[model samples]
Target chain A: MPETKSQSFDESQSAPMHKALQREIQLARNIQMKLLNGEKPELPTGEVSGISIPARLIGGDYFDFYPLGDGRIRILIGDVMGKGIPAAMLMILTRGAFRSAAGAAQGPGQTLTMMNDAIYKDLRKLGSFVTIFCADWEPATGTFVYANAGHSMPIVVRSDVGTVTLPVLKGVMIGGLPGQIYKEKTSHIQRDDLVFLYTDGIVEAQNAQGEMFKLDRLSGILVEQSRQTAEAIQNAVVEKVNEFTKGLPQKDDITMVILKADGDQRGV
Target chain B: MFKYELIDEEATTVISFEGDLDIDATELMEEEIAPKLYDCSNIKIDFSKVQFVDSSGIGLLITLIHHLRERGIRVRIFHVSDEVRIVFEMLQLPDIMGADVLPEFEHS
Candidate 1:
């Protein structure tokens, strides 16, 4: 009788342990999904389409859109240093920080500064860093002010003209240093202009030949897809990237944000 | 990517990081240390060991700076390497993050 009781107790314990592990995995998946499908903020002027595709169930890439008051819109894109759950969690933190700071009436430069200060200590504790791009657009005046924090250069496409790569302002990766000041630059948005922001995952995407997708290819695609709507352009870019990889395993998360400045649709 | 080391001083905190300062590092920082930002006013970070960084890292830093500034805290940076220093110069981070390369340690 005593032997039977011991066996039963062991079985019960094992069952609960299994259930706990399953629950933890589920929770991790849920968090990753949330990061992938982040909350979308309404646009003050033109339509915006943002997409993030993680190489793994949990990825290190992130993009975010948030509306600022006074006809201003904030857009951000970032890449974490590593992969897996830790990277996903970092993406979440970055998204939250961008939203909170930009939402609190901070401009691109100030926002980057504040973010750097917020994470410097924690980053030291964990020995990690992040690259980011933050920009504020005023639809009313077609003015764009941005601060680059060690991210890729955003491409601007004009309906009449071809695509133009905006120059990156002087900035360092956040959390790597505190008190590193970031500069901001302003540009007048032309009519029917489209801004494209993306992560290295897109350019670094490899093919069977072990060749990277490269920026030239991305630029060509952007030029070809310039006529499409923001959402369509985003979809097309993702599709092209997938086709390029040809069902191969993705090594990193691919994320992109497309912003179109349409004069006629400014009210939207 | 983004990492840092914190040294508690009399009235200031010295933090340093190596490798890439990207999104993953940002999340680790937020989860592990964001709460402590409320306590310090003077903060310094060293980025001599960083190799590459991106926009997400910038966003995280800006947010942190804003948080500390709101509480009347002052932040500084030291020992930024040349390669990474170019990135900071291009983004004009010095204007925003109060960062400057350490002049004392010449890059080898």
Candidate 2:
């Protein structure tokens, strides 16, 4: 009779393996949550409110607002190419790169170009890309300068004209190619104007029948809820998406950043 | 919903993905596929069978792509459905991912 090889087993191994995995997963969740809640850099001239909802425990979406020395606010919203640990990791990289590049006094376009170059140079090392939107707001002058790197175009809600979707700032996704040039554009925000920055999660949310929440719905919501505070606007947007999904599991992270020019005529 | 299969064609590793690429599948992919990324030079992702992909899925792909690109490795995708293709095009990722649209196979 051929001797059968005994299978090795520790009765205690199963439980600890499961427990260790659970602990690791929990730790990851906590880290991601902390990154999401990281301090909102102080705005010297205006107020800023931002919210991010990961479709799950981890996500690829991110937003940030920081005050510049020249009395302008720097706002950034971006989506990494993938989700989960990979996306989360890339989000961290993009955030770091953007912050460093912006701190060097680079304008939106130049900052984006440098960021794109940095990401692209590391792309072969990281094997991913990101789409980003960076903007500078001069509270005193009510002038807004923005650059887009294949990210979603922000919606501007004017006091008199209602909701308006700005054109794409014209650029490809960061880390996709080398020497890509990002275009910067400028616009003036009148008193009481509202600027809404968001991730695709909001508009792409689906209903029971698989219908999209749609941009029109989002625009309508913005128009109706324009008077709400930044926090309220974030909450309202989440609520609308939740209602539309009707209890479906959120498929992606949802992030929104709202800035309202308080109609102050004082220029910085 | 997610399913994965490893196919060997002419020494190339083709991991075929099907169904929804969301949070659940994203985790599964990281667990099952991430380790293998370092082992192959020519990695082909078959998304023709994929139904839907959200930001999480895109994030996972980006991470994997970034890692592979760093190693001087390239990832190729094939069989993308119309919907997944649109998402890629919207994000302008085809050129970066080196994904090529293959001719649809017709059965006579």
**Which candidate has the highest TM-score of all?**
2
CAPRI grade, predicted model 1: incorrect
Question: In order, what DockQ does each candidate have?
Answer: 0.14, 0.31
List where candidate 1 sits over 4 angstroms from the true fold.
A1-23, A263-268, B1-108
Docking outcome class, model 2: acceptable
Worst 10 residues of 1 chain A by lDDT: A259-268
TM-score of chain A of each: 0.87, 0.89
Fraction of native Cα contacts reproduced by each candidate: 0.26, 0.50
Q: Which lDDT tens digits does candidate 2 get at residues A154-233? A: 88887668987665555677876799777789988765777888888888787888788978999988888777666677
- Report the lDDT tens digits of candidate 1 across residue range A199-218: 88888787988677978898
lDDT of candidate 2 over B1-108, digit per residue (tens): 788888877868898988878666756777878777678888888887997777557757767776777797766777789977666666666555554322232211
Residue B99: error of model 2 in Å?
Answer: 12
